[model samples]
Target chain A: MDVFFQQLVNGLTVGSLYALIALGYTMVYGILKIINFAHGDILMIGTFIGLVLVMNFHLAFVPALLLAMFITALMGILVERLAYRPVRAADKLIALLSALGVSIFLVNFAQLVWGTETHPFPVNISGEPIILGEVHIGTLQIWALGVSLLLMVGLHFFVNHTKMGVAMRATSFNVDYARLMGINVDNIISITFAIGSALAAAAGILIGVYYDAVYPVMGYSAGLKAFTAAVLGGIGSIPGAMLGGLLLGVLENEGAAYLSSGYKDAIAFALLIIILLIKPTGLMGRREQQKV
Target chain B: MLELKNVMVNYGVIPALKSISFKVEEGEIVTLIGANGAGKSTILKAICGLIKLKGGAITYQGDTISGMGAHLIIRRGISQVPEGRGIFANLTVEENLGLGAYVRKDKAEINRNLKVVYDRFPRLFERRKQVGGTLSGGEQQMLAIGRALMAAPKLLLLDEPSMGLAPLVVKEIFKIIKEINQTGTTILLVEQNARMALSVANRGYVMETGQIISHGTARELRDNEDVKKAYLGH
Candidate 1:
């Protein structure tokens, strides 16, 4: 097996997961023009919810994942309602601060309830690795890549084709005009949070399934990496987030295989800095057009 | 159909609209003509529920709509073609029109209204698939008016539709506005171009320094020396 190809596959599997979380960041940022700092903690909460559903209740993986995603979506809405909504009209900085508060509250709350100990993830499916001429691919890799792609495609169709999705885009374009068009902007915002959180939840559970370990602090590091991916793709663009995540994942894995495993996290941020330095708007971010 | 009774609005400490009162009886084109900073746009915003009135009441068909949410106000058959055209630059022309009918759930009715809008502006029909931003200024203004029309509003509020448009295009837009009024949709038009506005309007109000300085028929405003000097630019 080619070492480079093998590492690339490994990187893509992880990157797809990152893309999922990055989507949440990009989406909320698109609507509110603020980074949802609490999105990371939402990932942690989703993992724990998944863990309890599968481990304690003995439910199947798919059901648990869906349930966790639904619950995490509600948690997302709750965070927006409690922390972000009241401060929405005050100052942009206040909303950012409230997001940080929500992030901290979720992390400590998770520690208080689920504790700091890591729980081994309960996905017990097994399959032989798919071998090509030079690379070995596992079922988890396929699952991670396939599920994320499916969700992303579904999201794309929903945002582009559906009425509510069009309303979301309209609201993001101009809040006042959206209100003039009879769009309830507050509901649109809540729906944005809900969708973003659900995607993050799915990513969180996938990370746990891939690593076979679920822990409270996983979100902190993973979220930072995903956030880097979001910025890499240009913050508010959806496809940019996905592309950024995949690219970051591949780069991180290649760097780990060639340079050192200890440099994996550093590689992600390093790539982010390099990308931002070159393109400032991330990969897919639109350059502001000044019409004469 | 719509009336603003002593409506006052402020942008922080600076008063934008000063206890201004105006009326638009059903099926009439009532133009509010003023220079920039004369609160012409502010009155439109207040009527559409985009801004809270600092004081006074706005009644639509005899019900006080002053404190209603902007989103809810549209559902009651009031829609606005705001200043700047307010097109969703990223959305296609068809999508922009679809959003105009958002408050209504009846799909068949929406498509019928879509046909009416398209027929009224064949230029929009030709470019329906293109994103709204790429359209010429006049086309965007048409899309803005077309979008408001899709709401099937009883009272339509137009804010500076002629801003940034060619003279020929302005003539065409005002023609459509006249036709829309003939079809029984009441119009409250705010315009900086006083000559064109008063020419098309049945009744006209001249505003200055956040107050209506003169009010009369189009011919009355046309004959008034002060109106011609300040706004008609003769």
Candidate 2:
């Protein structure tokens, strides 16, 4: 029982990180219908930015996190303007290829600047593990869970209750109709990229604190996992991404502990394939019907 | 009032509209009736600035709006209810209506419009919290028109509001269109349903293969033998 509880806690912590990153993927996909392959590398760039603020500038944790999020968001907006916007009205394949190209560029750029070595992030928060009954939990895990929950709540309100949120929803459904209704689609798309990138940055910061390491290649694995989570929950569904992330994390963790650690990544991919085979629209995605 | 003189539009190399000319006076319900592929919707698209005018001028309230973007055109008090009822499926009915007033800055006026829309379409009010996608086809059409009204446009352009609806629903929709026009909003209606179009329109134009074949008052067009044979059941 204790072992099960411990594994559950560990899985949930990792799941929260996946959920945060997956929200970015799912939200952008929801609005733009583009995969945004560069999103993963944006996470890598965000972590590096946060590392620089903490290690080089010796800034405190909160300020470093904020600066990292702001810079990464700006990077997201710049990439959209330079790489994504021009090809937006073009073929979908071209936009997909452009996103992939941007991903490669950011990853290589980070590698050249930061080197290949894995840098350990200095912990400003205490490393003491909290013990509850027979189960042990890390303090950083608690922080990760708390921050992720807060961000998700904030995002929910922003998407549902606000005026800009309504415009964003309108744009996602029908671009021409949104424009006809007086919503500036360009501005809405920019806001989407900004919010998505900011969430990715938050995930990067939390992951760095939890794992105590950062590297240029770190984004590849995390990105793949978050993408899987988004698909599992439903690509265009926000709550679906969160559910998928949690399910993927818990399943992978428990499978690794009970079966074999070498098969952890394989377990996630296998679940994804199985889910797609069973329910292609995803767990929460509704099948849309067209009128002739 | 709105006027389109020698306006043209193309999709890639294929010309959708070729130097089309028309006018809608203030407080008039004017309709363009045509068979499919006659460029009726394209004309509306040009007026709303969804498509670039290849040649000619569009004047709304005596100001040239030919080169404006769709958002700017709406801000200029012209709103479009697009074909097939382009409601934001994922949003609630209230949220969809809120989007129509995206450019309006007055909170009290927005509230007033919200109340007015609710009062006009009680069915929409009943489903106010429902997702736009979940609404029935008739309900979706009502929401689309109500959404445009939320923008308080001087001229409302409706594209095929009767399409894909049952005859009863179509009657209800046309009745609402007449009600909307009677409330002092100028309207430009495009329809393949020529009978209904002619019934509610103060004036009507017959379009065929991207050109206006004929134009006159609704009663004259309704009485014409060509219109009787081609559009209204003989």
For residues A58-157, could you state the per-residue lDDT of candidate 2 as single tens digits? Answer: 9988788888989988888899999989998899899999999998899899889999888888858755778999988888988888888888898889
Each prediction's DockQ against the real complex: 0.73, 0.74
TM-score of each: 0.97, 0.97
Model 1 chain A, poorest ten-residue lDDT window? Answer: A283-292
Q: Write the per-residue lDDT of candidate 1 for residues B1-234, one digit (tens) a residue.
A: 888999999999999988899889998999999889999999999998899899999999989999998998999999999889899998999999999999999989999999999998999999999999899898899999999999999999999999988899999999999999999899999999888898899999989989988899999999999988887677
Best-performing candidate as measured by lDDT: 1
Off by over 4 Å in 2: A126-128, A290-292
lDDT of 2 by residue, B1-234 (tens): 999999888889988888889899999999999899999999988898888888999999999999987888899999889888888888899988888888899999999999999999999999999988888899999999999999998999999999999999999999999999989999999999999998999999999888899999999999999999998879
lDDT by residue (tens digit), candidate 1, A171-261: 8888899999999989999999999999999999999988888887888888999999999998988899999999999999999999999
* Chain A fold similarity by TM-score, each prediction: 0.96, 0.96
Clashing residue pairs in candidate 2 (N, C-alpha, C atoms within 3 angstroms): none
lDDT of each: 0.91, 0.89
Q: What share of the true interface contacts does each candidate keep?
A: 0.78, 0.80
Q: What's the iRMSD of model 2? A: 1.6
